[model samples]
Target: MKIDDLRKISVIGSGAMGSQIAMVCALSGYQVTLQDIQFESLEKAKALLNSQMNKRIVKGKLTEQVVEEAFARLSFTTDLKEAVSDTDFVIEAIVEKLDIKRQLFAQLDQLAPPHTILATNSSTIVSSEIAPATNRPEKVCNMHFFNPALVMDLVEVVQGPHTSDETAEITMALSKRLNKTPILLQKEISGFVANRILGKIMNEAIYLLENEIATAEEIDLACTKALNHPIGPFALIDLTGLDVHYNVRMERYAKSGDEADKPSSLIVEKVERGELGRKTGQGFYAYN
Candidate 1:
């Protein structure tokens, strides 16, 4: 199917990423459904989206009429079948766990329209690992959007071996429609492009903190002031949530069986303490 054929979008999981994605699609004039298994999760997503959209209006980035129309175009549900029954595209932004993703894809494959394309928002778990769970492997590809999807500009579109050319092109086109910069990876790779580069930096930052070579603030300051990076590794981790990195590391370790691939001791402790970053009110630095 062509990009024009995609009239409806269903985002599975009502967390921050999923909610922002649904809002982006709706704001771009597509009908969108944001789905989660729990009612409370859906409510939180609603509040989160409303707050962000209102911020856009306050900043004059978007008009009130436009935000209202975007809100009007969105629907929320707990029923997976109801969410995907007529959707032309499905973007999965649930947990990073491979088994959970495969299970959800299996269900989405059975529920979504036969012509719908399935895209994953995972930067670490490539679509190749999840495509086998569905009959339409050709329609499965990676459309990894960075955290805080509404504000972040970059999206990585990964085309797996089983993915069709049309699927990749359409996903790229759709991402552009959402006003995000889409970088196409002709071949699938774990962590795609951006995250792979960022992971190395994050690991080194964790090592430095663990060795007491520098504190999180000092390391972050060095990255910003010396390297000229817009944000420090530790600050970026906090913005994106430490749990996400922890899961990526865990997944890598699970597959490689190498202790070196395991999450850093610092990250493990932070996640254990529920200091997941901006969403949790604390991470490397505290947020009010």
Candidate 2:
């Protein structure tokens, strides 16, 4: 289907990524439905969206009328069937578990309209694996968005083994409509492009930390001062959540085929202890 034909959008999972995606779609003038298993999570998502919009208005980035119109275009529901019922596109931003994503797609395949596109906001999972769970494999692809989806401009539009050319084009158009920078990924490489490069850098950083070669501050300083990176690998990992960083690393380690890609033992131990970084107020450096 043509991108203009997509008027209604559905986003699964009401976490930070999903909620922010809903905000983008709503502001883009698409009718948006944000869904989650828990009604409370949906409520929380709505609250977060409103708060963020208000912040934008206070900062003079958006007008009050724009915020009101955005809210008018967005809705939330816990009923999976209702959420997927009439959507032109479904963006799945659920947990990073493969089985969970597969089950969700199986449900979407049966619920969404025949021509509705299915995209995943997954940063690590291979699109090919998730595509098979749906009946329309050609419609399933990856539309990975950065964290805090509303603010991030870079979006990776990934094509799975079975993804149709139409699906890629439509998503690219949608990304542009949302005012994002869309980078097409022609292959299903592990971690796609951005995350794979990030994974390599993070794994090496952890190795240094594990070996007592440098403190987190020093590492962050090197990237910010010397390399001119806006954020250091360790700081970025902390902001992204150490638990998430370590978990993705483990996935890469399993599929990366590079010994250096394996996560450091120290990283696993930290995540096991629940030091999830900014979200949890602690990580490589204590946010508390």
Candidate 3:
């Protein structure tokens, strides 16, 4: 389908990424449905988006009327079928698990219209792994959006061999409509482009923390001052969620059988303690 054909969009999952992505689409004038199985999660997402919009208006980035119009175009639902059945595009931003993603796509393939494009916001799992579960493999591609989707400027659009030229082109066009920079990778890789490079820094940072070479604060300061990165590896993981980090590593190790792909001891411990970053109010660094 062409970019103009994509009028109604459905986003599965109601977490930070999913909510912000829905916001992006809604603000861009697309009718957006943000879906989650739990009613509480949907409520939380609505509240979070409202608060964020208000903040933007207060900062003069958007007018009150514009925020209201965007919210008018946005809706939340607990019913999966209702969310995607008539939508032109579906973006899955659920937990980073292969089996779960595959299951979701299989259901979405059955529910959504045949012409709907299915995309994933996963930064780790490639679309190829989940596309096999769906009949429309060509419509499935990785549309990885960085953390704080509303703020991050770069989106990685990875097209696997099964992805069609039209699918990739339309996704790139949609990204532009959302007012963000989009890079297309004709070939698909596990971590895509940015994450693969970022993963290396995260790995070494985890090692340093495990070895007690430096405190998280000290390391973060070094990264911000010397490397010119806005946030350090630990802080970045915290923003992305420690459970996500642990899961991505575990998933990689399961596939590659590489010891290096296994989650670090620090990550495992943090996840076990339920210190899953910003949402949980604590992670590598405490929030509030």
Candidate 4:
């Protein structure tokens, strides 16, 4: 399938990644349906997208007319069937659970049109494992986007055992059309590329904190000054949220069977205390 062949998109789940993905597609001129099981979640996601667009307009990065057109191109609903009914493609951006993803794919298999390609925005789970459960495993592939999917340029076009070449090509082309950089993973891997590298740095950072090597502030400052990194691993983890980091780390660790992949006790302790970084207003440091 060619990129132009895809006109309508069905985006399942309306969290940060899903909502951003939908906004990007709509802005790129595709008719987008943002669907979630919870109506309230859908509402929140819609409002958040609007807020983001407003901020961009205020910053002079986006025009109000473009924002209006983007919103007009989007349709929101809680019903899965209604969203996928006429979509040319489906992108599943649900939670990182194997069973939950498979179930969603199975339903999409029955609901979406036969030619509709079903792509997952999963960061860790193997696309191959999730594809077979669906009716069109050949059409199933991974289109993993980073956090703030719309703003991020890189998109991992992951291919599994059953993934067809055409499916991969279409996704790659779509990424370009959406003004994103797309990298091809010839084979399936646990962490793909970006996350695998990120996971290692974070693990070492946790190890440092666990061994009491330095204060979190000191560690963050050193990375920023020495490496010119925008944010230190600990600070990034805090910004990304400890619970999300822990979950992705656990999945990758399980795949690699690496002991170092296990998240440090300090990380878990912070998450347990609800110190979820910028979101919770505190983590390794407090936010005013």
Candidate 5:
């Protein structure tokens, strides 16, 4: 279906990325259904959306009327079938587990209309890994959005071997309509482009910390002041959550059987201690 013809969108997760994506679509004037199995998660997402929109209004970035209209176009639900039944586009921003994602996509394929496009917001796993679970592999692709999806401009549009050109085109156009910069990848690679490079940097940072080459603060300062990075590696980890990084690394290690791909000792300890990051108020650094 054409971009303009797509009126309703369903975001099948209510976590950080999924909620922000739903809000962005709603702000762009699309009817959005934000679904989560847990009602508590949906409530948290609602509060987060309100707080974010209010902050934008206070900063003169968005008008109150616009925020109200966006809210009016958004709805939350606990039923997946009800959410995807009438949606023209379905963006899956759920957990990163391959089996879990495959199961969800299989269910979505049976629930959503034949013309509905299925996209994953996965950072490390490729669409090819998830497409086989469904019959319509041609309609499946990856649309990876960075953390803080409402603010981040880059949305990587990944095409698996089975993904049709039309699916990629429609997704690219949909990303543009949300006022994002879309980059299309012809081949699907694990971690895609950004995270593969970023994974290297972060692994090196952990290596430095592990080997006692530098402190986290010093390493972060080097990246920010010397490399001109807006945020340091440790801070970025905190923002993205230490548990998330650890999980991704564990997945990589399991796949490659490389010791170097395993989670850093420090990250493992932190996760065990419940020091996730900003969400938990502590990680490599503590937050107020």
Candidate 6:
């Protein structure tokens, strides 16, 4: 199906990324259903969307009327069948676990319209691993959005082995419609492009910390001051959540059986302590 043919969009999961993605589509004049199992999570997503839109309006980035219109175009639901029954595209932004994703996709494959295209917002896991669980593998692909999807412009459009050219083309066009920069990946890799590079940087930073070569502050300072990165590895982890970083690393290590791919002891310790980044008010740095 073509980009214009896609009217109803369903975004699964109402976490930081999922809510923003649904808002982005709504802002672009698409009917969006933001789905999660918990009503409380959906309510929080609505509140977050309002706060984000208000911030944009205050900064003269979006008009109040536009925000209202976007809100009117959005809906929240807990029923999975109701969410995807009529949607032309489905974007899954749930947890990064493979089995969970596969199970969700399999259900979506059965619920969504025959023309629906299934996309995952996973930063590390590729679509091929999840597509095999569904019958419509050709219509399944990865549409990886960076954290804070509303702010991040770059989106990685990944093509799995079974992904159709039409699916890739339509997704690329849809990304542009949402005012995002889309980069196409011809082949599937675990972390794709951006995260692989980012993972390497974060791994080395953790290594430096583990070896006691420098404090987190010093390493972050070097990255920002010398390397000119906008945020240091430690700070970014705090923003992205140490648990998320650790989980992705563990997944990679499991797949590769490489000790170098394993998560840092520091990350493991933080996760074990439930000191997950900004959400928990603590990580490498304290938000509290």
Give the clashing residue pairs of candidate 4, or none.
Answer: none
lDDT of 2 at 136: 97
- Candidate 1 residue 9 Cα shift, in angstroms, is 0.4
C-alpha root-mean-square deviation, each candidate: 1.1, 1.7, 0.8, 1.6, 0.9, 1.0
- Which lDDT tens digits does candidate 3 get at residues 144-234? 8988999999999998999999999999999999999999999878898888998998887878888999999888888999999999998
Error of 5 at 164 (Å): 0.5
Cα error, residue 286 of model 6, in Å, equals 0.8
Residue 134 displacement in candidate 4 (angstroms) = 0.8
At residue 155, what lDDT does model 2 achieve?
Answer: 96
TM-score of 5: 0.98
Counting only residues 3 or more apart in sequence or on different chains, how many pairs clash (N, Cα, C under 3 Å) in candidate 1?
Answer: 0
Candidate 1 lDDT for residue 274: 98
Worst 10 residues of 1 by lDDT: 188-197
TM-score of 6: 0.98
Per-residue lDDT of candidate 5, residues 149-230 (tens digit): 9989999999889999999999999999999999999998788888898888898898899899999999999999999988
Candidate 3 C-alpha RMSD relative to the actual structure: 0.8
22-61: candidate 6 lDDT, tens digit per residue:
9999999999999999999999999989999999999999
Put down candidate 2 lDDT per residue, 103-218, tens digits, no spaces.
Answer: 99999999999999999999888779888887899999999999878888899999877999999999999999999999998888868888777767776777787789999899
TM-score of every prediction relative to native: 0.97, 0.94, 0.98, 0.94, 0.98, 0.98
Which residues of candidate 5, in runs, are more than 4 Å off? Answer: none
Residue-by-residue lDDT tens digits, candidate 4, 56-149: 9999999999999999999999989999978888989887777899999999998888899999998789889898898788899999988778
Clashing pairs in 1: none
As for candidate 3, its clashing pairs are none
**In candidate 1, what are the lDDT values of residues 1-288, reduced to their tens digit?**
999888999999998899999998999999999999999999999998889888889999999999999999999999999999999999999999999999999999999889999999998898999999999999999999887888889999998899999999999999999999999999877878887888889888989999999999999999999999999999998887899889988998998899999998888898999999998999999999
Backbone clashes (count) for model 4 = 0
Error of 6 at 229 (Å): 1.3
Flag the better candidate by lDDT, 2 or 5: 5
Q: lDDT score of model 5?
A: 0.93
Worst 10 residues of 2 by lDDT: 244-253
